[model samples]
Target chain A: MTRAKKTWPALVALVALVLAACGGNGATETPETPETQAPETTAEPFVFGMILVGPQDDRGWSQAHFEGGKYVEEKMGAQMIVIDKVNPADRPDTSVEQVVDQMVEQGAQLIFATSDDMKDGILAAAKAYPDVPMIWSSGDSAWDIGKAYAGLPNLGNIMGQMEYGKMMAGCAAALKTETGSIGYLGPLINDETRRLTNSAYLGARYCYENYRGLNPDDLTFSVNWIGFWFNIPGVTLDPTQVTNDFFDGGADVVISGIDTTEALVRAGQRSAAGEKVWAVPYDYRGACAEAPEVCLGVPYFNWGPSYLEVARSVADGTFEATFQWVGPDWSDINNPDTSAIGFEFGEGLGDARADLEDFIAGLASGEIDLWVGPLNYQDGTPFLAAGEKATDLQIWYMPQLLEGMIGASSAE
Target chain B: MKRALRAVPAVWSVLAALVVSVGLLALAGAPPFEALVLVLDGAVGDGGRMADTLMSWVPLTLASAGLVVTFVAGLWNIGVEGQVIAGAIGATWAARTIPGDGLVVIPAALAVGVVAGAVWALAAGVLKTRGGVNEIFGGLGLGFVAQSVATYLIIGPWKRAGIASTSGTEPFREEVWLPTVGGTRLSPVAVLLAVAVIFLVWALLRGTRFGLRLKAVGANPASARLLGVPTEATVLRAFALGGGLAGLAGAVLATGIQHKLVPAIAGGRGFLAILVVLLAAYRIVWVAPIALFFAILSVGSAQLQLRLDLDSSIGGVLQGILVLFVILIGGWQALYRRGEP
Candidate 1:
């Protein structure tokens, strides 16, 4: 028995030594520099790695961010390392540490966590790896909107004004609705989606009160939280069915708050079947190009400029932590850089184009406050008192479903 | 004693395959060695980390130990995943509805969880014994159905009110949470409980007459039944015991790691438990160490990702490779003696 124990220790040592040697060989195999040496050009390739919450093929939330990563790689010749399909359900708390460490070891000077779920992990990693710059998408207001990032110095956030796009959708709906009724397809009843839907409603209300001269009672807004951003197989609210439910309730125009545009495709099918319905797409531009005839416009986010700015800061060594919020300048329809809401008037909206321009200009000037007071819940309880504008905090965390929304607060 | 000692080298040979798999991951631009170290550290290097590792071990041990019983009865209970999920749901439901004394609450929660898990497992048992369906497919199909049910509750009926987030049940109150070892998430009571469970199983498998009958039935069910052993009943009981243990494990996990029920509370621990049982060769004592090793791999993988700048999932890949290598090398050494004349 003693001899057997002795044999086992020797075997263990032998295995350990073999593993150590293999590890040593692995480090040596890592390439130091390329063989092709250009004498004059001095710009070293800066590696920037990204951790995505979903697969790039998700074609919605993750894919939009991936396109931004690719844009940086193509434009500035930045070496991009991307890790995808991270399970959000598990303890993703350590994922940031793992990604940051991996990326930094691979000579990445900057890392990006492209999901809201990655916020805490990214924040912790930001403090731990201060030398390596970190950026997160759709994070807390403290990170960007306030002076919180000033202390951190190495963290930054980039987000578009999604509310502007919703407004444009609402504007289009108000102009087109013969019944003066509109339906909104929302993924979750969170502050972000609520604010957007509210803005859409306000815009619709503004156009009806100012342009169409219809009573506020005639307009209806319906919301269904798909329970999640996307439908899990064999579970969750079906987005297509939800949209059909809204259309069945006599809603001519539907504004989507969900990630993917399958709802838009469903709307296109309805239009093809002679239902006379319209859809306003979110997240990406020219997505409505597939159904231009019934497509009202695209309320798109310009993540390109923001992405370039963030990457360039890393390259120039003058990057500071700040929340960068870029919105529409409202002058012309030509420049894609300035506008958060890309207004593409439908084939049927030839005469109404002038009216949309005026509304867009007014929104840019802040002449209309979307969350002004005198708002009532569907049960007629006052949400906002008369003449009371919602505070930024209240706007950021809008809890209750607004009046005229078609669906319940939660799925159940 | 000598034969037991000899198994160590064979085990290492199997583990060497795991090392090679890590190396392969390194080739894909990940740091396997560092990740491996992190996994080790995460499993047991310090008190806090050990506490976390032990916390992970509780559910794993419970399910794996139960699997040994099913294996002994010649039944593969693959539906432990679904059973665990069902158990969590039942436990969560009980925790919400059943108002009781503080002492009784936890025990009641565990009982509810175990019963739910057993019921899920027995569905497979009934299908196999009565409908003549294979336990493997029946268990797997039941597991899927259970997952859908959990998903339904999380996304639809059981979702927390006033929150517009994704599908998930309401979080458990602090009062309902199990007592932890000191302030850390690790429960001393859980460890003691698990030890008691192991002892009970060890006794059942080794010292009892039923144990011998189970072994005989597993070895040759037709012959055992011919010799007056009730094969179908033994198989069904084994499944119930297995499912009950797995359900208890699910309750522990829900009340421990997640602190709430979500659609993904099981997190594939049920399926991984199968590997744990196989690696231990269905030995209860061996499970304690092997499960710890797997947990360490998971923890160390993060460190490896940081240190080597490699993908963190290299640990999972290494785990698969380790199991594969162990089986291959163990088979080769068992069948064809290496370094022998």
Candidate 2:
């Protein structure tokens, strides 16, 4: 028995010794390749890495980013290596820095970390791999005044002017709502989401007053923040519940700000159950198709142009870190030809298309300013002085819901 | 001769698992040897990476060390994950509500966490003893409830302003933040506490009469009861003690690493602790080292995807294979013993 016990301890010791030796040997032998390489003037395909927090085909935020990646792949003939469903919640064992290291080791000269939550991870990796160009999506952390901003020479931030798209969606929702009630299905109440929701409310109010010939005061716009980008059951209120609650509370139009098709799907089901409900979906181009019968339209992001531009710059050795927030092309706001923010009207909209188009034209001509002075925050505090147009910085950090909206600006 | 013979099967099983993993890696279009090298390098390649591994190891060791006690008492504390979550929730509540600095806040939060976790586990124990429910089912159900409760709190009353996020509660006040060693994630005090708990558990199981009585109940409860042992009390005590340790791990996770109560704060480490206990063959002495090894594997294998273009799932696959091999070898030994007797 004594011999057996002694031998077991020795065997464990040997295993430990072997593991330590392997680890030590690996540290010495592994080459520390520079993450960034100078752009070569060859026709060789540039390998780039794209990291996504959710599945590529989630049909929401992640799907849009994946489509952007695909666009770069097709246009530039670049080799695309993607790692999807990389949520900190689901995979706590892995760090974003480690994933970036993996991408660097695989010879990716540039990487796109495409989630707001991935900002810290991407920043850490940017510092670790100083040569590799890192681009983060929907984040201003690389900007000069951003809260988490760092002056990393190799890091940049890019996001579309989605507020305008959201405004258009709000217009469509207002034109379709017979009850003068619009439900904004908001996903978390960050500055980004708050700004988008406020933009949508402004558009809805504008359309209701001008086209619908209704008192804007009578038009009710209520927002319910779901506390996350998507429903996590008991962790966050189910988007389905919020959607249904909106409809149950007499909202004829439910506008989704989340990353899923739940709003449209639920609206479609309610519509089929003999209710006259309308829905607007966000993110991907095909989101309206999830419930086309109830779909009003989609304000989708065309990430292709932005991603293509960044990749081409890197390939041409002209890449510089900048916070780029591209807006819609005025002449062709919904044009696949020019705009980063495109609005696709769904089949559910009956006879409101021409009016919607006129509204868009007015927006493009700058004849109707949504940021005009007379706006008060939800707390009844003046948000914009008379004749004052909101600056990009002001819009980016919008802190409260505007007047004429009913809902908590912050979660309870 | 018998010990040598037993070791052979375990060694063969492990080799078999490795060979299988290598084949799987090849199928995934990665060079197996290179991938292995990347994992090794990523895990302990430098001081920073080793610290990261240790950061993960501390909480895991604490939880698994607790599991060793539960497993020794023949209890499957599947609810340890829930206990961990409950602990975090309790700690987060205290951290948010209690007004103080790190010294005062940390201890108070951890104390609540221990009590909450113990109570949560004891509910499962009570169900088993009083309501004729299996601990596995009861514990699993309670775990789901605990998660739901956490989710509700995070998204509702406890949510951060201007952004109710799954990102978790807004970070605790800086003054209340656990002290770290040199800006690394490793909390020196947390590490010392974990080591202390491990030693305490080791002493409790190895040198105490209570430990012997618990073992007697676990070995043959009916016989132990007939011999005047208080089976129910011993079982309940084991559950509470195990739960308290798991809770402390949760508090450490919240106060040390996460700094906020994320929905995935436990990060499935509760279940991972079960695997650690099994790998150590339910021996308390082996739990810490084995937990450290698993932590290294998890932290290091994260690099495989970057280096070899392999999936991060490979880490999970490797852990699963090891557990499967160990269990198979154990089962084989048990069958051999039955045949010999």
Write model 2 residue lDDT over B1-341, tens digit each, in one string. Answer: 96566445545665777888788778766778888777778888866677778878888888888777877887767788899999989989989999968789989998988888888889998999889898878887998898888877876788766666776777788666678776455678888988898899888888898888878876778999999989899889988988888888888888877777888788778877876676676677677777887788878876665555454456766766675666566556655665663
CA RMSD per model (angstroms): 9.7, 7.8
Q: Interface RMSD for candidate number 2? A: 10.6
Model 1, CA-based lDDT = 0.69
Model 2 per-residue lDDT at B27: 72
**What shift in Å separates residue B133 of candidate 2 from its native position after superposition?**
6.4
Give the TM-scores of the predictions, in the order they appear: 0.68, 0.80
lDDT (tens digit, per residue) of candidate 1 on A30-72: 2321221123325877778777765443445666676677767
For model 2, chain A alone compared with the true chain A gives a TM-score of 0.88
The digit string of per-residue lDDT tens for model 2 on A340-385 reads 8888888888799888888888888988779888789999999988
Q: Give the DockQ (2 decimals) of all models.
A: 0.17, 0.27
Q: Top lDDT: which candidate number? A: 2
